[model samples]
Target: MEESEILRRGLDAFAELGYAATTMRELARRLEVSHNFINDRYGSKEKFWRAVVDFALLDVQSELDHRMAVGRDDGERLRNVIVQLYRLSAKASAMNRLMSDESTRDSSRLDYLHQRFIKPFWDSIEPTISSLIAAGRIPDAPTHIWYFAVTGPALALAQDPIADRLNPAASPMAEQDRNGMADALSSLVLQGLLPLSRGDATDRNG
Candidate 1:
């Protein structure tokens, strides 16, 4: 079997039994091969897990690229970007859950996540935000704040649909709540930035 196939089967095992609970033998069984086959391909379970994480992040990157290509103004772009990013959160949350469970008290997985997934995501998107700022689509849009506003609810939205329904009073954000959430975040960004554009400022100060 291909190395990619081996990683795919390993990820399936991780999803089924969780990272900590999943073993190479379980993955080999899923692949219809001996554990030695998996070991020979990936060298160890950690390496296999790392491959799975990389694959999932590539999925996220592909989705993000598509969203960026859809062409929208700043507000609509933010909404679309957030929607796309949040959509991937389901798979990401599963990976995140596995990482946390597998590396309990060891936090190395968290570091791995930042390196393997989060940083690449940030690097890809940050320049887009810069372009938006240069085009007067957003003003003073700090990357951290923008990122937090757009992506903060990813884990909760992916992991807890019922919690969103049960507590609309406090946390009214479900996985399907993308439209409203997008509107709210878009409004916040546009209202903050549009007023600071050159034309708007000239009108105000002239």
Candidate 2:
């Protein structure tokens, strides 16, 4: 089988079983190949895991870069970025699951994923966010808080089994539902970030 096909199966296995539970034999079984074939090609499970992450993240970074490039203004850019994230969460649910699971512990794999995928995406968007803040388009809030507010819901939605169990009515499963939720979340985020009126601002400052 092609390496890309192998990596795709590996991604699903890792996402479902996580790193510790996944094995090369299991992956080979999923791929309908001999275990020796997998080991011969990738050499080790760790290398296979790295290859999977690399494959998934390359697509993510490309899509995000394309979406961010299409906006005409900072506000539009921010909205575009948020929409892109929601779309990615829906499409690449496995990637979301894998990252979230890994993030709870401190590991070299987590660091590698952060430096390669997460950091670059954040660095790319930071300028647009800063520009909006500088222009007083958005209220001054900590960067991390803003990120959470924008990303948290969509990420939650990606884990739909948990989300559905928690609240089936609000869980986004269909494309239309996902788009509607993304729109509502984007509006809420933008509204929260809008500059407060002078009286309110002054009152808070005082």
Candidate 3:
């Protein structure tokens, strides 16, 4: 099978089983290949894991970059970036799961993922995020808090069972409803979450 297919499947396996539970042979089995295929090709589970991470992140980075480029101004760009990430988190559910799993520990896996993906992703958006901070439009919390607040709902759209149970609609949300939800969520981050910062500014000025 092609390497891309292996990487895609590996992403799902690692996200589901996590690093400690996943085995090279199990991955090969999932691929329907010889049990030792992964070990032979990647030399070890660690190398294969890195390859999978790199492959998934490359695609994410590309999409984010494109979204950033299309914006006409900083505010628009920042909003676009947030919207795109929300879509990606739901669309690339495995990546969201893997991020949540790795973030709970202090392992080299977290370090590797952070150094490779999280930090860089933050760096790209920091200037825009910071501008909002400077303008007193968002909370003055630590960077990591902002990261979590923005991404905490990554699984909300995918919890089909829970959403279906809670939602009163007879059918699933229409595309229009989904789009509206996305917009509302973005507004919550960009506007709703800023009351604290705005209050602080108000106190200082008045």
Candidate 4:
């Protein structure tokens, strides 16, 4: 009934069922609405899926934009962006799940995701990437490698079942734990990607 609730449930259903197997009727049932609600309101199932994506990703895009605007430098900006992304993924990983499934196949949905989210996201971070490359903090790598590097780390957040079994206390779903987890991930990722300074390397070597 409520638009946000509908979109959230739809996003989760699509992520769980996959695009083809998730019928509009099933979505309506999940949402506890009439089976034709999407057809009547959104025009079609494809359009409904698009709406769900648009709704679910808006906050993430906004967070990235806000984070990109404020960092002391490119490296700092990259770290801030990654940390914010981890926070968001911990908040809700449905979009990531949907993306993981869609990425394995070539479909219109995948194209839509690329055109709408993936390309824009990459473009948004191009300045940071360029600055890092120039500073030799990161390599001048291919787009796909950068893509996987940035996004792949967050995939584990989507696996609550495994996490609950393996380390219940460290579950990312817990809000109080998210900031520490994000910071830890940012440190781990940046340390591996970034070239250590002369003094830092010397300290480690010593």
Candidate number with greatest lDDT: 4
- Please state every model's RMSD to the true fold in angstroms: 6.8, 5.9, 5.8, 3.8
lDDT of 2 by residue, 1-206 (tens): 77788789889999999999887778879989887876788788888888899998877777877888998677767777887887677667788788888877799889988898878888888898889889887766787877676667666645677666676775545434666666666667666655345864575599
Candidate 4 lDDT, tens digit per residue, 1-206?
68999999999899899999998779889999998888999999999999999998886787888898897677667877887887787666788789888989999999999998888888998888888888777888987898788878776667666766787775544444656666777678778876457865675599
Order the candidate numbers by TM-score, best to worst.
Answer: 4, 2, 3, 1
User: Taking the tens digit of each residue's C-alpha lDDT, what string does model 1 give over 1-206?
Assistant: 87667666666678557766787677777888886875787778887778888876666776776787674554445546666665555445555445445534456766887787667777867777777778766666677787665555564444445766686775644344554554554456446544345764575498
Sort every candidate by lDDT, greatest first: 4, 2, 3, 1
Off by over 4 Å in 3: 155-161, 168-184, 194-206
TM-score of 3: 0.79
Q: In model 2, which regions exceed 4 Å deviation?
A: 166-181, 194-206
Q: How much lDDT does each candidate structure score?
A: 0.63, 0.77, 0.76, 0.81
Q: Write the per-residue lDDT of candidate 3 for residues 113-139, one digit (tens) a residue.
A: 999988878888888778878887666
- The superposed Cα distance between candidate 2 and the true structure at residue 202, in angstroms, equals 28
Q: How well does model 2 score by local distance difference test?
A: 0.77
Deviation in angstroms for 25 in model 2? 2.9
Model 3: lowest-lDDT 10 consecutive positions: 170-179
As for TM-score, the candidate ahead, 2 or 3, is 2
Give the TM-scores of the predictions, in the order they appear.
Answer: 0.58, 0.80, 0.79, 0.86
Q: Residue 144 of candidate 3: its Cα lDDT?
A: 84
Give each model's clash number. Answer: 0, 0, 0, 0
Identify the superior model by lDDT, candidate 1 or candidate 3.
3
